[model samples]
Target chain A: MSTLKNGIVCSPAIHAPGEREITFSQAIREAVAEEMARDERVFVIGEDVAEAGSVFKVLVGLLDEFGADRVIDSPISEAGIAGIGVGAAITGMRPIVDIMFGDFTTLVMDQMINQAAKTHYMSGGKLTVPMVLRTTLGASRRSAAQHSQSLHALFSHIPGLKVAVPATPYDAKGLMKSAIRDDNPVVIFEDKMLYQQKGPVPEGEYVLPLGQADVKRAGEDITIVATSSMVYTALEAVDKLAEAGISAELVDPRTTTPLDTETLIESARKTSRALVVDEGYQQYGVTGELAAVIADGAFYYLDAPVKRIGAMNVPVPFSPAMEDLTIPSADYVFETAKAMCG
Target chain B: MTETNGTKQNGAELDAEHWLQAYEQMVRIRSFEEAANELYTSARMPGIAHLYIGEEAIAVGMCEVLRQDDYITSTHRGHGHCLAKGAALDRMFAELLGKEAGYCRGKGGSMHIADQETGNLGANGIVGGSAGIATGAGMSIKLRGTDQVAVCFFGDGALGQGLLYESMNMAQLWKLPVIYVCENNQYGEYTHNSKTAAGSMIGRATGFGVHAQGIDGQDIRTVYSTARLVVDRARNGGGPAFLVCNTYRFRGHHVGDIDRPYRTREEEEEWAKRDPLKLLEDWLTKTRQADASVFERIQQDVQTAVDEAVNFALEAPFPEESEVERHVYA
Candidate 1:
């Protein structure tokens, strides 16, 4: 088995040699199509999901392949569709509720949180809601405050929900499949900026289990735990940190809810330092939670206190220059890592 | 009993047996609610419960026409609906008492009892919360090509909620097999409906292009006949319909709200005179369907069953503490 410089076992390879490359959007579409074909109970319901193929076009051609019966285009009623999704799931239908924008989650909170999340437990295991809610996260697309917020943390806080934030095309496909098959309610947040980014994906069926962390580039100097779009940001900083003789390990926690704290703590213990990067706000957000976890688990081994790099605590600005400054960038991660390594 | 115009007595064609069965079911609901109220007043039951005492006719009338596989989503005040839909009295009482053998195994106390075998989706705590769920069940039935239908039971308080309209709009647009039953029980909580709801209740559904009607809730015969027509239309792919049952809440919103200052006692007494149970009982006696002895026998038998259920709940065990984390996932 491959091992990092610090002698910790590395995760198994996600892609084999000469694997075909596909865009993150294409990977998502393929996963949905495959699942729908495999299970007749699987169907997609949302606004503009049928002929429009989603506002992001991530679901393009799904309408044609699945037909109108499965690819149902609903009225602009997020709460209504989400409730329907919960109701349908309990009654033997595996529904994928596609919220065009993650901001509209506010509209469906009652259904997703109060209804879907509580049904199984409230029913004392009698009813199971095997449903998936697919939406986008991250900022810097000039979409302004409402559309640009990374709200995965909100869902992660809920007890019954499983939150998946995939950073790459390969992870997107595998994670989507896993979420579809999960018996509980799951919310998968895809980074809008990473939709066009291409990555290696296999031809055959595969699924990456939830709660498993992936070590993108294992190192021994400092451990960097990132989620969703921030994974790419951390990876970019790894190259710059290498020039400075800093071997920064990059860990991608694909699902925030079923977080793989053991891997993160082991990385932090080996490196003696940890930095959590996420696109959510710095205060009471994903970064704070992960940093606390690392600090608590690897406290005695750490040379310095755990650090958190996240979006500035403000609504996403509309202007490009302002928005760019709000989110954590590669330079920010590099500078923070260099200072910590010193 | 005051038989208002447009009240169709389609149930007149039925034999004494059917009417007797309806009377028995209504009596069971009344007994269940009375026992539940006594438990609360005597401080035996935990939390609070919304009584469906005065509106027994609506639940029994509507649930009578539904098939065993047909679905129903209930409100906070849902004991009557559960009993009418064939939920066992023992399980229902056990659930209200938070027992391990309850319908929801004590996880859902009073407001959230879900019985899968009887096709009860659940009783929601949130006003108008079950509207979308019922509509979705309708959507599922249509997709699966089943002849089943779903009924959504809510109060006039739900008429002010936007989710109800959103659900109704989709139910009509897609031609889903759903029946929206609005039990306008005169008051939304402590306030009367006239102060809370504007415009006609039926107009709201009719505005969405859904067939809508209003019926006197006190009369079991009218409620049953109306429910039969609407349920058959929905099961035969006739899309959605809305039925407004004009009724009254004979008790406080919850067991604790005793001194109701919103409405006068004189008004309460006036509505009490048209009690659904008395109306049904009087009809049975006047028509000689059976003598007063038959009604007396039903009351005694139903009371015994309810008393046994209460005893079962009191003796049942509480769920293990570890069970708290068991079913959170699946």
Candidate 2:
């Protein structure tokens, strides 16, 4: 069968090798599977995380391999899911919680911030919380404001958390493995639109360290830094800007908390112009913070004022037309980059 | 180096040292509470402090039976719990004083003092937060095949919280080594016990198939014996137990409330008359043949220790503002 009953592709073992490139969802599954096999402490838990796979089918076929003991299916309460994850982390097990939506993090903020973040510090650095909270974010497919928000800003403000917003299948798998290994709590913000986006992911265990930025493309005229879903948009925008005679440098700070300010400042110095695009709202968005940092550090090196292309200062709309306008699309990033270059 | 080992006390017979140790802790908690009340009323302390004056027996009683490696989770009224669990006096005092050398580096203050080395997992400000944590600690102990057990100390008010039931179910289901100690201190911030706790506290545990027991918290000996039995069962791979220590709080609900209009002055006097500290002291003298001079010497030692702790805390410097970003990660 091409797909399991749960609408997930069978493992590579079931089919011929090199038959097809792995999807983003399949990459995440393989990452968890390989890690769980390597470390007995690693496990997965969420609503339908074990028996029915995940809501997005990311954990499909894991239960059959790891058994119900490791791949636990929990109750529908998001608060309970986080609460259990915190408790399980404090105990001997390492848990990866699949929060169906990023919005549901609100229900479990106390467990996340108070319990998970402060436990090790409060215990005087004796305890470690090596847990991963994987949640889907961004506005697309008309999922509305509640389901489609890119709320990485809320977590980045917290001290103990390391936010990983991977924009590609390879980064998604590698960053997740790193988050699983990090002693502190890490939030893996997966874009809803990028789950089906496929790319090359190396087999076997791999990790992407926190606080590093990747220069996806090199240009001389303007520096454009974006994250998560906007990284793809910024790349597309670079292609369009090139046709318009604008050289746009694309930098994706794959990890948000340990923000690679060196990369950002260097690019701003070289191009002497910069533009930041974020899927979240502009007010107090990551774009605003990025602008302030660049203005403070790279003020003398810049030739023109820094620009920001961000979601409108409003909730994600339900209508496809309004949602399209609300999110930072490739056309908006391209226009913003061209304006920065000019 | 000398191997430091605690003298084991069985629940069957009351050994002189065991009873004396239990009474000494009860007296220390009482004196500390009395000092805290005076300090809080004098406005010497900056923040609101929850006094465990009348509820001394529960902490001293339970901790007396636990090994140094066994873990404990406490409520907002946590000073007594930490003191009874053998937290360093200077650090706890520094925490109370909001000094840099405090348990949480002066950040947690009175509500969140923890000493992980001695197995005090920090006091939780939330009403029912410790239950699940202690349950988790129990799971950890069992997973490692250790004899250690975790004792969760919560108020009667926490009995209504759903997390308590959730933790209890998990604890009983796994037969984890845990003892849920509900210090029924009779009030939840001005709400009477009758109004807050519906049904019986023991029934809350028995319903979850955990062996439940209610004992007189005014009698330190009784509390210690009952806790020893339950804790011993947990150490030997038996299931969890729910222990209800029927107790009272002699002071106001918090440091801010001077006028306890909810409860009558006569009721307070009546509870105070059966003071656990005085009762244990009297019992030691009359029944156990202990000397008055010995008790006086113990009192003087505790007073000197507390004074030194206060001085250390007052002299300790506050953490610098530049260091705020430090220790955010492991």
Best by lDDT: 1
Question: Taking the tens digit of each residue's C-alpha lDDT, what string does model 2 give over A23-66?
Answer: 77888888889889988878786778887899888898999998
- Tell me the deviation in Å of residue B217 in model 1: 1.5
Per-residue lDDT of candidate 1, residues A259-334 (tens digit)? 9999999999999999999999888899999999999999999999999998999999999989999999999999
Docking class of 1: medium
Q: Looking at model 1 chain B, which ten-residue stretch has the lowest summed lDDT? A: B1-10
Q: Which stretches of candidate 2 lie over 4 Å from their true place?
A: A1-21, A87-93, A120-127, A141-146, A312-322, B1-12, B37-46, B159-162, B193-214, B236-238, B282-286, B289-294, B317-322
Task: Highest TM-score: give the candidate number.
Answer: 1
Q: Each model's TM-score?
A: 0.97, 0.87
Q: Spell out the clash pairs found in candidate 1.
A: none
